[model samples]
Target: MSDRNDIDPFYDDRSDPVRVLVVDEAERGERLATGLEAETDRIAADTVPTVDAALEAVDRRPIECLVSTVHGPDGTGDELLAAIRDRYPAIPVVLVVPDEERAREAIDSGASDVVVAESVSERCFVLANRITTAADRYRADRRADRQRRRFREVTDAVPDCLWIVDPEWSELSFVSGYERIWDRTAAELTGTPEDFLNAVHPDDRERVRAAMDRLSDGTSVDLEYRIRRDDDLAWVRTRGEPIVDDGSVVRLVVLTRDVTDRKERERTLSALHSAAREIGSADEPAAVYETLIRTADRVLEFDYVAVDIKRDGYLVQEASTLDLKDGGYYERTSLENDDTFAVRSYKRQETILVDDLREFDVTPADPDYRSALTVPIGEFGTFQTGASEVGAFDRDDREFAELLVGHARVKLAQLQDKRVLRERTEQLERQNDRLDEFVRVVSHDLRNPVNVAKGHLSIAREQYDDDSLEATMEALERIETLIEDLLTLAREGEEIDDLEPVDLATLVPECWRYIDTKDAALEVETDRTIAADRNRLRQLLENLIGNAIEHGGSDVTITVGDLPEENGFYVADDGTGFANGEREKVFDPGYSTGVDGTGLGLDIVRRIADAHGWDVRATESDAGGARFEIVGVE
Candidate 1:
């Protein structure tokens, strides 16, 4: 017996030695086993006396190779070989036969190799070599099997479909993840690689076919197209890469992903953007409501859509896709009732989604609707959508509906602002009409009485030189001055009719001549020509000049100059400036600091500036006097 520590010269160190079971009568089995082990340590030989023992030894542990004689004590070597091959197909079996004919017969019956008993001693090395070769081959086969299984596991776990096809696309060599994306098992596409095209949407079939052709021609392709899964269409993005061999295309690998959700979101955003533009352009609330209903219908494809405006404590249906009934074009629901989805959403000021109206405790406004999604358009109204199918609305549907309602809300708020502005404008026009009537009455009625009093005072002066009569004349003259100031205030409040370029250099001196300046000095520091109503400009200059003389005493110097930086002009006086905080009050109609001052002078100046679309502000001049600057000329 060889010691366990003895290393055989023929054994390879790279791999473990092959274990072989030898079956025969006691003497031949032992002799053959010893001879095989003596030739190489790579083959570990064990002796068994019968076929049953050989089968038992093979099953007891890992046996890489089996060596058995043609006949044994209990059964033929063929029986052992058959059993080992049937149970452990990966284990190699080598048969030792009595003659050449028997060796040929053993080889035909699934034997790895055959050795003749007559040449046993001479061919011992050959037998050892064959055993080691068979074991190495078996290990390689096992490694390949494991690699294939791992590949399948990894590919099957991915969410996208992976497939490998020949250059012609006639053979589908490998496929995985097809069941999930295609809604069909991989077996259905095994023999027919082109059958996937049948699932492509009819409109996209030609384009997909062209992409496949490009892949066959050694060109890579990335494509997004729609495919039909049952009755619904799904968007899929596919990338195909050509596998080239020696500069020629051999196969093509394709990866496909289901992108239906991504495509739907993009579509929703595009539709909403277009809807916003249309809704914003609508000038009236009714037009905005109609556009909202139409856009909601086009985007969601819902069975019914309604827009309700909150008016007079009711949700008045302003627009709807439902047919009008009960001799009215719309319906109204009381907002106090929380049973309806629209009212509930309006009160909460948020979005409400009901998958099934029947399951919810609240009653749907439309009994025919089984699902509903309602969104509030701020305090203005509620926008609602409904469908006849239960559970028809999903998270995506609710989000899309909310987006449309948000756009509608913005346009509604704009419409509301426009309405308020129109109403205020009309109210101001009515007040202006009454002011014109008051101005007319003061011009004719009041001036006549003052004129008659002056005439009576003149007769009294002629009859008797009385001091009381002189006082009466002064009082009547004051009344006439007050009437003239009132008329100027009323007339100047209107918009400037026609604008002609007026030179302040000429107009200023002319206005100073009209004002009763006892000893006041005037400086026309500006020579600029500005567009203005000629008559209105004269009135403005006269009032400002008279105000300066009255407030600044008789010897005040008034300066009129262009504010180049301000793009307008300023009227300043070298007199006692306004008291602290009196600049702001000077423009008020009835604000007067002097007892005899009518206080309408500065007020009229502000109105004329406004009619010309100019901004006016009062500040102290450089000489500690009042400065009124009118900017924003153009």
Candidate 2:
């Protein structure tokens, strides 16, 4: 029989005719090599009668892969493996051994892989690729030692933890720096990284374990989560890069790092940014203050937050989004000699962040509140209607209470100003409505009488054949017509709907029929539909088209067309377009820049559109007249 530790006894492949160097005892090795060549045209075999020739070819020549015996007549294969490793360290050396013990020795001697001939084909390809790749890596590694060192240093410089594992989630090796990973001492996690995770708070263990499994399956993972510490919980990250052997995952390593501070800052900044937007958009002072309370809680809700709206000189806590809701904020306050932090803050209109309110100025005689932050709402310089308070607290919360309060100051001022302005606007709008209604009714009633009188005078002048009387009647008729147009414009706001979806297709044509088109041309163009209140939309289009007619020259054209160009829609007219400076003012009740017209027509158009959440703007149209565009809607 061939030397027991020669190359594979069975022929594995017959393609691309492999040239294999078989190292074994002289006589039996030649027999097997000869048999292998005769068995298949796919294999071309060569025999090296001693370990010496095997070592020489492996060291000096370019061989695709190697097949050598671990237990030769001389000894075990370590000497041969060592020789190959010294010269071509990257070349993977596959040892043919009869037993696992020999295989182990072969591997330790720097064979890239090991296999037994009894099942050699089951693993020949595997061993062959390993030897080839290991040899190549060995050569490159020797050449690029400096680059490898720099690469290692750079990888270490990255703040995140890195790791490697197998598809089975078994750890191969964590980096050397894994010891100092968390709040735990290195002694606490000396053996395995899993043990460190085992010490994690029970709540986070399952999730962390799951994340580890996902990482093992060749996934790029980015996650934010809490990691338990000895005393408290801290946020951490577990990240990894997969190492694939033979195009399949052989091992994976992962890194973990603490990110508590950065995550907390992000949360705070996000809350502040959100609060800023909410404050800017809030129409009601209460709604804006509500956003403030929510933001304070978002930062440190566990600490306690109280929102007070001062009424009748009493600090009435209107709402609280606290960690412990319904609890008395009194116990959380620092009141020294009857002056509480909340009171002082409200009185001075200043922001105070208290780490321990009860301990501040506390001598048993002056036990003030502890761990409280007071943000005052004194903007509008005259909420004089009352004072307000929104406070936050937490144990490990970031020291962002004042920053939050800083965010609050500008927004509160804006909200309060908005509130006051809204109230005054309501008052002014009411007075103007009253004045417009008064104008409408008086004008409507006076207009008809004037027209009737003008008609009778015209008839009398015609019957009496008096040219002077005819001129007087004609002047009166003209006056009557002007008054009637004013009355119609005033009454535009009279009938708005109770809010329902109005089909623009149905509404535009109806308005065109009702409006006074006696002096101007009107056209309705519809392509798509709009959801709006029925009568209100009709009125909006009515006033707009009527004004186009009233202000436009003799060939006046009112084109009610959908604005495909505008994000929403509009009505453009070929008349004298509204003047640039007075466009915005055109919506105000008494401000009209049109010739011989009451300005309320376009104002009615704007108010009705605003109530429906549509924006109306005036621009010059290609139609050689004014264009009112409603933009930014779906």
Local accuracy of candidate 1 as per-residue lDDT tens digits, 383-491: 8888888888898888877878887888888888889988988998898888878887899888888898899889889999989998888788878888988898887
Candidate with top TM-score is 1
Give lDDT tens digits, candidate 2, residues 297-343.
66664544666666555666555653334434542332233466666
Residue 569, model 2: lDDT of 73
lDDT of 1 at 59: 65
Specify the highest-lDDT model's number.
Answer: 1
TM-score of 1: 0.71
lDDT of each: 0.83, 0.61
Task: Indicate the worst ten consecutive residues by lDDT in candidate 2.
Answer: 380-389
Residue 9, candidate 1: alpha-carbon lDDT? 29
- Would you give me the overall lDDT of model 1? 0.83
